[model samples]
Each structure stands twice: as C-alpha cells, then as structure tokens.
Target: MRGIPLQKTLWHLGVLWRKSPLALSPEARTGLWKMSAPASTFDIFLSHTWHTPGKWKILSLFFQSGWRFSFLGWFVGASLMLLASTHKLLPLFIPYRSNFDGATISCGAASRCLLGSLLGHGLGLLLSPYAPSACARRPLCFLDVASIHQTDRELMERGIYSIGGFLHVSKELQVLWSAPYLSRLWCIFELAAYRTANPSGRVVLSPLFVECGACICILGAYFAAFLFVFALPLQHFGIYVVYVVGLLPIYVLMHLLRRNILAKHQLFEGLRFFTLAEARCESDFDHDFIHTAIRAWYGSAEAFTAYVQGSLRQELLASKPTTIPLRYLVLLVGVPFGLSLDFLAALIAREAPMEWLLTEFLAGCLGFNLCWFFGSVQIALFLCDRFAAPWRGGLFDYLQTLVLFLIFFGVYFLGSLMASTSNLWHALAVASASLLFAIVTLVCRRAAVGS
Candidate 1:
C-alpha cells in the first residue's frame, strides 16, 4: 500500500513539472523584459543597433549586402569628407591651447584647415629626404603661435629661449611674414632667431600677397556661381546651375595648375639675394646670415648697415628651367571656363540664330578675358624673375617690367586688330591672343635657358 501511494505521488509531480517548462520568478521575468527592450538612440549606427553579440552578426550581414551598390558609389568619399571637415584624421600629436592673453587664435578657422591640409599633402616639404615616418613618434612641428604659455612669465621666457633650438632642429621653417608678423616684436625675434640658429637651413616663405590673390580668385568663382544660380531668370535657371556645377571641378583643376606654375616658375618674387655683404638699396629682401646672427644675438642694428639687402641667397641651388608643354598651357587657359572650342562652334552652327550665337560669344569673351588676365599675370611673374638680376635690382628692373607690359599690350592690340568686327573671328582672336602671349613667354624662357 505505501509503495503504490509513493509511485502515484511521483507521477503527479512529474506531470506538473512538464506543464510549466520554466517556472520563472517575477523578478526574473521583469529583468528579461528590460534586457530585451529597444536600445537608446546613442547606441545606433545610422539607425542600426546591436543589443547583443548575435545582433552584431546580423547587422554585419545586412551591411555586406548593401555596401557596394549605394548612392553615387562615393560613400567612401563622403565618409572621408565628413572625417576631414571634423578634423578627425589629424591626430593631435601634441595637444596645445592658445595662451595669447588678448584673443584666442587657435587653428580652428581657415589657418588650422590649411595647416592640416599641408600636414597631409605637403609633408614631404616639411620632412627631410631620409626621414622615416615613424622614426620620431611625435610630429616635429613648432607651432609658435599655439605652443607657448602666455600668462606665466617664466614659462614664456623659457619658451623664447628654446626658440633657437626649435629652429635649429627643424628641417624647414615657414614664415607667414604678414603685417602682423612684422609688427609683433616676438614674431620678429622668432625670424631672427631662426637665422641665427641655422645659417644654412631651408626657409619656406608664404607670401601673403600671392596667397591673397588666390583666395580672391576662389571667392570670386564661388560668388559668380552663386549669383548665376539666383540672379538668372527662373525659366532656365536649372540649366545654368548644371553648367556652374560642371565648372567647379574644372576650376579646382585650374587652380591647382596655376599654383604649380607659380611654384615652378617663381618662388622668390619681389625678393633678392646678395653675394657680398653689400647689396643695392631697393632690394626687397636680402639675406646676411652674419648680420642676422649678430642682430639676433645682440638685438641691435649696430652690426648691419641695411636690413633689406640682396645678400640673402636661397638655400637650394637654382635648377635648369623646365619647359612646360603646350597641352598644359591650353588646359590652364581653357579648363577654368569649361571651354571646348569644338562644342561651342557646333552649338553656334546648329542654333544659327544671331541672338543665341551673340550671347554665347559674349559669354565666351568674358571667360577668355578673365583667363587672359590671369594668364598674363602668371607670365608677368615668370618674366619678372628673369629680369631680377643683381645688377638690375632697383630702377632697372622697374623699367624692364614696363617693357614686359608693353610687349603684352602690343600682342593684345595686334590680335584685336586681326579679329576686326567678325563675330567668330573675334572669339577666336581673344583666345588666340592669350595663347599667343603664353607661347611667346615660354619660347623666350626656353631661349634664355638655351643661351
């Protein structure tokens, strides 16, 4: 009788346990609900979230399917642009805060952006030929504006003293040499200190004048595009906008080419170097290392007669002038306006309306004129260098430059005369005029080199 009851009780307990597979506690049920709830917005990547390890695998699989065939196939470019604008790519090797007492001039604005770009693109300019990327863990940059402590007199003094060491060890020294740089006593000291420390070191000069011109050109292009988009009649605004959009990449290419031309043709404009201690009075800049060292050491003008002499020589020996090809000149002249002579000619022929062709011609004229102005400026700078002999430093150079202008003017006058009231001829004439000038300049340069 006792065995029969015990077997019956065990069967009942087994049946109840099978009915409730998991007899969870109330607290356990609540904890599970909380864990399974939706994640916060912060945890999502472009609205995809992973609450657990398995969910991460699911997300990855989903991403793999759609990664390649996306909008514009430029997702990587967009990502990079975003990263660059945020300055996430430029890791701060040395963290520094602005210590200037009056105003905060940190590299957050255009200066910072340009510096960051130079760091990435122009690292070779700053680095020695044999220098290894990882030989020094830290960036060997001396941001004088950003590095020193402003309030502490003792710290500032120490920073000033170490300026020489910084200049001495630096492979390249870049001087902005703007009005503010000239006015600041400390900034002048830094320049002087660099010369004192390294008589033979490479110094890169950032001429504000040329940089400003480039900036102005960029701003003007943007403004023109903007104005065209809004100021035009709404009937064909979309078409004009498309044209503007097409011109943007070309403008960038043109700007890069122009900069390369300037760098290749003229590095030291309105400046000079002298062989002996003495130089002409009107030379814009002269390098005298002994005088520089003396002035830096003593902070007095007693050791030097003239601050601006042609005695300062460029560290690098001048190389033979390389002849730029015709195709490059054509691109530099035409690319900025998205100009295709064949396309324009075909369009004019197909349209065959006086108003339309005239309009196009006028537009082409404007583009060609602007290109001519810029091209002439570049050629002028190039020629200015050729005429910048030590003996021809002062009034002689000024007179020679006038002659250069006369030559350009004469060419333009002759081209205009040839165009002479014919519409097609006029358009061709303007472009040929500018092209002719560039060609002649190049020819002259090549001849000079040959001699």
Candidate 2:
C-alpha cells in the first residue's frame, strides 16, 4: 500500500481548534506541521462528516477533549458549594425548618443562591483549565478538512487515496457522529478503513446529540434541585402541598427526559440498520475508489458490509440503552448533591442540635442525594430500553409520559419521606435500603450488558 507521503501533514489538535481548517494561513499551516512531533504517525484519525455544522463539531470536540477535566470541575464546584454553605460564608437563601417550624426564604434570595452556584460552577471549570500548552500535548489528529488539501485537486486526490495509510498508522478513530454521518459515503469509508486497518484500535462513537441530551439532563437536574429547595420549607404544610407545587416542574422534567431518551433511540436504530449501499457519495470517482479499497482490504464489498452490520453493530449495542459516560452521570448527580448543601447551611444557621444535623446529613447525602438522584437516573435509563420504540403520538405517548413521571415521583416521594422522618434509625434504614437498591440495579445492568 502507498503510504501517506511526507508532504501530507498531521495537524496539532489544539492548532486545528484555534486556527480552524477553513481559515488556516499557509504560513500558519506550515508552522503547525513543523511543530507536530513524530510526523509519520497519527494519534487520532478524526472521522466526521463535512456536512455537520462547524459549531456542532467544535462542541463535540470540546467535550471529547476535556471530559475528564469537566467532571473534575463539577466535583470541585460541588465541594466548594458545600464548604462555603457549611461555614456560612455564603448566605442561606433556600428555606429550611427552624426546630420543625416553617420559615421561607425570599424568592430573590433563592435566585441569588442559584446564580452563585452557577458562577461557582463556571469558576470551577475555569480553574480546571486546559492550558494551550497542555492542549498542544494532546493527540495529533488527521482531520480531513485540515490534513487533506482542500483547494489543490491533485494533492486532494492523493490525500483522499492515502486515507487508508493514515488509518493504518493512527492509534484510534474518533467519530464525531451526527444524523447525517452514517449516510455519508466518505464517513462510512473512513469507519470501514480504520476498523479494517486496526482491529484492536479504539473507535470512539460520539454522537453529537449525546452532548445535547446531557446538557438538557443537567439543566433538568438543576431545575429539580431548585424545586426541591422550594419544597423543603413547604414540607411542614403537608406533603400534598409540596406534591401539588412540584407537579408543573415534574411535568417539564419528564418531557425533557422522554425527549432525550427518544433521541437516543433514534440514534441507536440508525446505527443498527446502517448499510454501505445506502450511503451517498458526491462523486462517482470517489465511490469507485472506496469500493475498490474495501474490496482490496476485506476481499469483497459484501464482506465489509457484513463486518459493519454484524461485529460493529454488536460493539455499539454493547453499551446500549444508554451510552452516557460515568463522568456525565457524576455531573448529573452532583447538581442535586451540591444544592442539598443549602439545606445543611440553613440548618446550621438555625443552630439545630447535633443529632438533628446528623440525621439531616444522612438523609440528604445518602437517602436523597446519592440514592434518590443516582438511582432514579439509572432507572429512567434502564426503562428507556423498553419504552423507546416508535412514538405513536397519541394516548400511548401520554401514557408513556405518565409512567415516567410516576416513576420519578415515586422515587422523589420515597426520598422525601426518608428526609422528613426525624428518627435516626429510620434514616439509616432508608439509606441502607436505597444504597442496596442502587447496588443491585447497577450489578444487574452490568450483567445484562455482559450477557
């Protein structure tokens, strides 16, 4: 096989992000290529569709690049929120009972508390910064838009033909997937070539919609936390009042949750049914080239198709039902956990006895925050496997919505009941049971995935 020519350059991922492919000056490109270490090999083969919006691509890349840091940032922010609230450094804006007597915080104060938490989160992210120097040390990627010649036809053809060589040398393939990605002939070629070239190499399937869904889920969690803070003071006014007040936000959250799950289902279905024949190419010459390459690599087009439809399908579905990373889950769970710190601060400000504080701690930390929030998310995702079918958009959809809402409501009610009880033994029992439930659910899911 003809290898990638020395003139074909690998781009620094940071440089590519900074001076985007569309606007790279010749001198800058030459400088970046010179800056790249081990010019013959690539760290990543970026498989993406040119048709995807640049903004979406950038966002996807952002998440891909700094996901670890993002998780750490969230953790730090949550910790800081708790620390500040415990020390009474930040004002207690969320209401809490004073010796089981009801007292409400002003709405303005609550809004400020929310705003402070957001700012703290943003600050935390900034603190866990990705320095330019650090980014420069990241993988050297073969991004076609930058790596391949765009304006020069001869060089472009050579680069296109040399993609197989690129894949052979690259360590991993990172697919910046969108709805149109699978349907693109070039995208399919890249995927097939990379897998064929390096069977043991990592192929990260990052659906663009996953990040969008994660953001929506995070926002929904924050909204739920906000409502929980509001409902805390109202618990003294009968649990029914709290439930009635929460219905609207609960409905909103359910809608968002269902929408996210459905989007994931659509993506999964697309992957399951993907076929090379259905993929489109802009040029007949390119199509022929890809076909010839696949035939050469895999013996025949039919064999390559089988590999994608069989092995690739199984690999993708292995993490099915929910492909969300654990880090994102931590971030999701952190929102409620962090917000619950306000309740702690409120108790401290009220000078509650140590026993009462200890009960609140166990109830909030173990019972409500960890057990309720984490377990509930897992249950929703697990249930999505069964419920995420074709949307009939009638009574069925409403029924699905109701089912989801009730599941969430039931989980919330259990956690609330645990928190409301003043008995330490009750809190401990609820916490232990909740923890056991979470552990069992996780173990079963892993077993199912393994099977």
Candidate 3:
C-alpha cells in the first residue's frame, strides 16, 4: 500500500496507500489542475543526496536516447507542409505581398504579426522539456498561503507560470490584430475581460509584457524591411526613389535596435546562476513567475551561455547532461537560416514586377500570418510540460505528440477538402482552414491536458 500510485491504490484497488517519498505531497497536488504531469517532474528535485547520484546517471542516458525524436519531428513537420502544397488536391497557403489589403502602406503588418507570435510560441514548445521549466507548470500560488504574505510582482516573479503566461498573450494580440481594424478596438475590452476572469493578482506578467514588446518592436522593423519589396512593381526609378525615401532608411533604423536587444542572450543566463545559487528556504523572494518568464526569453544565447559555464554554477543540476553539439549546430543553421531564405525569396519576388501566377504565393504567406497571429498551441504547451512524466512511461504520452501531427496534417487536410470544391470567390477556405489548426491546437490541450 505504501508503494502504490495514489490513484491506483485509492480508487482501483480500493486500499489506503502509505507514505512514500515519490508520492506527490498534497501541496503540489492542490489547485485547479485537471491533467497533471507525473509527480516525478517535481519529485526528483526534492530527493535527498543519497539517491540523487543514480537519478543523475539515468538523466544523461535519457537525453542521449531522445535526441532522435526532436530531429525527426522537425523533418516530418516540414515535409508534411511541402507535400500539402505540391499535391493539387490539398490547399496551398500562399503569402500575399501587398503592402495594403486595399491601398499601399509602409509595412507588412501581417508578417510582423506572424513573426511576433512565431517567436513567442515557437520557441516555447521547441525548447520546453530540455529547458529548466516545463511548458505545463503554469500556475504558482502566492506566499504559499501557509507562509502568509507576498507582494504582486514578488509573487509573479516566483515560478507559478500560467499555461498562457509566457506566450499566450502575444499570440492573442495576433488574433486581435488579425481582426478588421474596427474590430481591433475591442481588444482592450478582451484584455480587461481576460484579466477579470483569469485573476491578474494571482498571475504574473513581467516577461510576457517585455517579450511581447520586444517582439512587436523587432518584427516591426522586419516588417519595415518588406517595404523595399512592396514597391518593386513600380518603375525602377520610382521603386528606388520609394525604397530610399520610405523603406531602406527605416529598416536600417529598426534592425539596429533589434540587433541590440537580441545580441545579449548570453549575458542573461547569469541571472539563473545567481538565483539558483542563492536560493534557500521556501522564502518567497526567489520563485517569481514574472522574473522567470522574462529570464526564459533568451533562447540560443542562453543555451550557449549555459554550455560555456558548465560546472561553475552556484547550484548544479543533478542531471546536467551536455547536449550533443550537432543538435545546436543544426539549429544555428536550420531555423533562422531557413526562415531567412523564405523571407528573402519573398522579398525578392515581391520586389520583382508581378507575374500573375506568383501573386497567389505572396498572397498565401500573408494570409497564413494573419491566421497565425490569433492562433495558439498553449494547450500543446500544457501537454509538453503537463504529461512529461507519463510521457516517458508509455502509449498515452506518445499519443500526445501525435496530436500535434494530426492538427498539422489536418490544416492541409481540411483546406484541401474545402478549397478544391470551388473557386476563390466562393470556395476559399484557407482563412477558416488555417484557423481550424489553431482551434485544434486549442482543443488538443483538453484532448491531452485540457486548456
């Protein structure tokens, strides 16, 4: 009885279980969570030194074993999108390059919106398990209630991340922006409503605000760069005149600003060392979600820093397995480079005088960005962190990754089903179809971990 899992012993076996170190204390179990990670995600941290050494050995083994899945997932997703576009029956989502939906403007709003969310949510899911925080561990309580006191930002900076805290708000902004301009006014009310229901006092938001602002500013610059692409259809002299006057100068201004903020990813990792090294009792100061969220924003730079500083940390991780250098080499080459190629091709094509056939391609990319802005996979974020324990154990966990693949495939599936049936004026389903992926992403949290 002492060793049995709580659920199995209490409900299924109809017996009382005894105390075990691995069992989750009622404190961690308390709260509104429906789907939960295996208690082990937390339990390992609490283990005493005598048993920690073996656990550390097992972790390195696990990291080595799981590298394939990350690589394979990336390839499969890219290939699926490729086949979906090439096969005629499937709907191809092309981006539009029009500076204005109706009339010319100075920037590519849709692309900016897409990139904002892409960076925010994209990195969250991609790096979750291997990173210090799991995507699922969203909520943190203030003062521990037992300890009985703390301030708002103080509480926030502790690690009680709401599933939506890190990336959801910005993605939601995408939804707000995707709306018709008039509809955009309603977003303030939407924020007020969300805060009212979600409880701003209990939740944290520092990094979220900072990250969202950084994303807006950074992508805002990238959007400005596309202006050079937008005026391409004009006479060469006219385009050059516009590029010099309206585009190139502005883009340079923006890029320099973003380059400054992004350049220092390595410097921020030191905060983690200081915090971990300094932590003591359940003192309320160190565990703020707002602080942690802000800290999480640096991705590769942070990883690079951590790799460089190995063995010197104030608090060394029990399982500090080194990642294979090739994995990161793949990323440094793959992500931003691949995205840049797509961006350059679009930028060049948009600048080139229009070929009618190519018009649809640009049109599709713009449309996808609009769809992407409002769409989120926070639930996927939840599952990635939520069921992480059950994940390594067996069938149910594997099914979860399948959930993302299903939605990934379904976007093309539903779009193909609807788009092939009619003409653009009548049968165009890509907007709603892309949204279907977003909705599936929303629902899958419940399917696996519930939103």
Candidate 4:
C-alpha cells in the first residue's frame, strides 16, 4: 500500500512538471500556440452603419425590381440630360418622393430618406431613353454594413480594404449628405475614397440636383421678368445678361479658391463644403483607417505632398490617361449657360431688333460657354495639382494659375469685343481660344506627371 501511494504521487508530480510554465521559454511557448485566422477577402465592400435598417429594405427592393443598380452620379447625369432635353418644367421642380417610409427604422435619419428617394427616382429614370445603360449591367450596390458580414471578424477586416477598391472603381458616387452622413466618421472616408477615384469629377451631389435646378429656374424667372414683367431695352438687358452669365463662372472660380484653401490646410479633401459641419461633429474613432488617412494627410505638408505625387504618379503610369467626364464637362463646364441661350434670346428679342438679337444671343452664348469651359479647365488643372500634391507649392502652381487667368481673361476680353461686332465672328474666336486652352490643359497635366 505505501509503495502504491508513492508511485501515484511521483506520477502526479511528473505530469505537473511537464505542464509547468518553467518548462518552455516564452517565445517557444508562443510558437506552440495557434495564430489568429487570416482575414477573408471579397470582391466588393460596402461601408455603412449598422443602425440603418432601411438600407436592407432598399437593397431588397433593388433586387426584386429586376433592375440593375449603379452609382448615383450616372443616373443623376442621365436624369439631368433627359430633363434638359425634354424641356419639361416638372422634373426640375418636382421632388422625387419614395413610397417607403425612409425614417421607419431610423428616427431622424435624413440619409435613409434620401437613399430611398434617390433610388426611386433613379429606377424611374432608367426606363427613359437617355438613361445610362452601361451602369445597369452586373450592378453592384455597396451599402456599408449590409455588404459586410459583421459577425465575422475576418470578413470585416478584409472589407476595409475593399472599401477603397470599390470607391475607385464605382462608376458614380451618390452621396446623401445629411446631418448624420456628415457627422459619421465613415462618411468622410467614403467621400475621400470617391474623390481619389474620380478626380476628374463623377462624384455626384444627390442634394444638388433639385437645388441647382431651382437656381437655374430662378435665374429663368429673372429672364422672364425682363421678357414680360418689366421690359427693358436690348442694351440695358445686356447688363443683366452679363451679370447672370458671369455669375456662374465667378461662383465656380471662387469655389475653387475656397476649396483649394481647405485642401491645402488639410481641413478636408475634395468637396469640403458638403461635409464641413458634420466632419466637425464626427465622433472620435481612434483605430479607424479613415483617421489614419487623415493623420497621414496632416503629418507634414511636404511629406503629404510627396506622398500624393507618388500616388498620382503610380496611377498615371498604370492606367489610361485621366480625362474629364463628359457629363461633368458639359454640366459644369459649358452646357448650363449654353442651354440658357434660347431663353436669353427670348428675353431680349421682344425688346431688341433682329440684328441685336442675333448678336447678343450668339455673343452671349459664345462668351458664356467659353467662360464656362475656361473656368472648368482651371478647375480641372487645380484638381489635378491638388490630387498630385495637396500641399504643392513653388512657382509651378502660381505660374499655372497666373497663366490660366491671363489666357482666359484675354480670350474673354477679346471674345466680348468680337461678340459686340454683330458678325458672329466671336464664336470663332471663342472656339479657337477654347481649343487652345484645352490642349494646353492636357499638355500641362502630362507635364505634371513627367516632372
């Protein structure tokens, strides 16, 4: 019996010694443990909040309708194009209202309402002749939290990388810039992602559709006043013409300067006005990639500039050369004022002679269109520079701005005179200048990359 007990104790002590912490070094012990699982990968990533339950409903509706989903910008551009061509007053003024209650799940969340409303409008517009069909095929809608499997940590980690990828490849970005959207940390990241993807401008502002249309319509009212309300002579009406047509370019130019200031100061990237208020209110998420990106952006002006240049250089070398979107080119560049040509003619035609009418119309159209294009080129160049290097400095940026200003101003100054000549020669002058400016812009962008 004593021998048996001693043998059992010795065996127990041996087992304890084998399992003791002193048996192996810390590194060796860690080496014996299993590692964490590698993150899962996916082709697409959607980024959004878990609180937005309505998004799932919207996603269901999208699939059930047998219609394809695309980015919001393509649809908005097509919608605007169609609305403009139809010469309809309804689409411009009428707000697109959705059947579903956007706020049903999320109280006071305006983005939910906007998402539903815009999708509804886009679905209706897709049936139209002018809708962008290319966007509909193999439609991929990335709705943040819905797209990622939250229960799986690996999937979520991989989803983060996919966010940047989807943003870069998406045909359009429809942003619902509500208070919640601006306040959320993820929303700002979405914006930065889209801006980097389409630096030449496919980033559509969902709210701007009606607002810009209304602004144009209001401008039309002023034109109508000159036509019917209080008749003014052609010469006097030209004052209003200059004021109206000129305001757009000036606004755009001033906007460029303001945005450049923001980007330079590292306050925000791309379109700052849309998210400024919300960004200020955004909750601190220390571990977020978005914050890391922001920190990298703020590290040092020179360091950030070099990093941007490196990124842009890599992008430029790898892909096709960057070209401005035709939609943005037409919309923001030269089309809005061109469309106003007929209305302008109508306003002054009633009060002026045929010669004066033709001259003013032609000249106004040419001048404004040229101005719009000039302003657009300036905008594009500035964006290119900003994208290439946010904190870019030295003589190049200044020289580029000064050169652009002088060239456009000279063209405008000459175009205004040629317009008043009543020979329609101003169109030719504007055409030549615009072509030259465009060529210069393309060349300059290339040069930026080369340097």
Best by lDDT: 2
lDDT of 1 by residue, 260-279 (tens): 33443333332332112332
The runs of at least 3 residues in candidate 1 whose Cα sits more than 4 Å from the true structure, single-residue gaps closed, are: 1-140, 151-154, 218-300, 305-310, 313-335, 339-436, 442-451
lDDT of 4 at 165: 66
For every model shown, what is its TM-score relative to the native structure?
0.36, 0.80, 0.24, 0.37
- Candidate 3 vs candidate 4: which has greater TM-score? 4
Q: lDDT of all the models against the reference?
A: 0.36, 0.65, 0.31, 0.39
TM-score of 2: 0.80
Off by over 4 Å in 4: 1-135, 141-143, 149-257, 260-327, 334-340, 343-372, 375-414, 424-430, 449-451
Write down the lDDT that model 4 would get. 0.39
Q: State how far residue 94 of model 2 sits from its true place (Å).
A: 4.4
Q: If ranked by TM-score, best first, what sequence of candidates would result?
A: 2, 4, 1, 3
As a whole number from 0 to 100, the lDDT of residue 69 in candidate 2 is 59
- RMSD in angstroms, candidate 4? 20.9
Query: 1-451, model 3: which lDDT tens digit per residue?
Result: 0011112211212211122223445543332122222221111011111112222222222222233443444454434433333333232133434332244312121222223223433333334334332323322211111111122344333423332332222212111111121122122222222333333222111111122223333343344435633554577588778755674443333333323323122222432342322322233442353234324542433542353255322222221111112332232222322233243244343443343223333224322432332232233223333332333435554454455435533453343343222123322355466566556654553444211
Q: What is the lDDT of residue 397 in candidate 1?
A: 42
